[model samples]
Target: MQPRKAATADVPELIRLRAVALESLGTNPGPADAPWRRIARHWFDERINRRDDCVCLVVGGGPGEPLLACGMAWITYHLPDSRRPDGRRGYLDGIVTDTPAHGRGHARRIVDELVGWLHGAGIHYIQLHTSEAGKPVYEAAGFVPGRYPGMDLITAPPGP
Candidate 1:
């Protein structure tokens, strides 16, 4: 299981995989409009290429074939004014594994590889939100509960 940075050429496949991820989350990405596709492509371009404070990785693929898993890390550097030194913290995002490849540890492998990379990049404190199904895998990777309770702000579309 090799993990590597996704390339521009991996966009279409990444989009497909993302669709699968959305399905797992119980929603479709949206209508198949050019604008939507363009938006998605732009997101992929940034995420896969680590543009704009993000680092994306793909696994199980290489010069020979298809990547079985993909993950992303959105990093925010601690400002000089902030108390924390070291200059790097990250949020884990998009740990999606192909259903057919489930039980093979594809997702875990990708995440482990990403964590190693993050550590190498001088980022040690990281956080993530996961579905119940995903919780066990993350736990197995040594993640523990945070001191603060998690919260979210839900916003609805305007103009009913």
Candidate 2:
């Protein structure tokens, strides 16, 4: 089935899918009742319902059921470069499917749609960090290892 753009109602299931993804990558998902989950609900509403720069898609499930897979990406801006004179970039936040739905081409379809959305928004440079288990799907979608290395700096302590 074709994936559809996620609505605010899908926010909770999307959070669950993200946690499942983190666990698959061997990262801790933390406690279920963590305060951050409450805040995340608001963030999802803002980003998915009120924003135009983001694209989030979900597949499977029904009117009252949990979702099977979801994917999200958003635009980013950087100092201008030759390839992207406008400096518009696409950051693929993540994609995930419930364990029962793995190996069914869900990730590929979601990635394809998310990429299409980004391209529709005039973004050609897309980037994402994939787990080893997820690398093949991304590669098949035309993603290649970039020449530039990824680095990050911690600007603040974790938690509120």
Question: What does candidate 2's lDDT look like per residue over 1-160, in tens digits?
Answer: 7899888888889888878988898888899887767888898889888999998889986798889888899999899989999999998876988999889998899999999999999999999988888889999999999779989997977898
Worst ten in a row by lDDT for model 1: 79-88
Predictions: Cα RMSD each: 2.9, 1.8
How does model 1 fare in lDDT? 0.78
Top candidate by TM-score? 2
Top-lDDT structure, candidate number = 2
Clashing residue pairs in candidate 2 are none
| Regions of candidate 2 where Cα sits further than 4 Å from its true position | 155-160
TM-scores of all predicted structures? 0.82, 0.93
TM-score of 1: 0.82
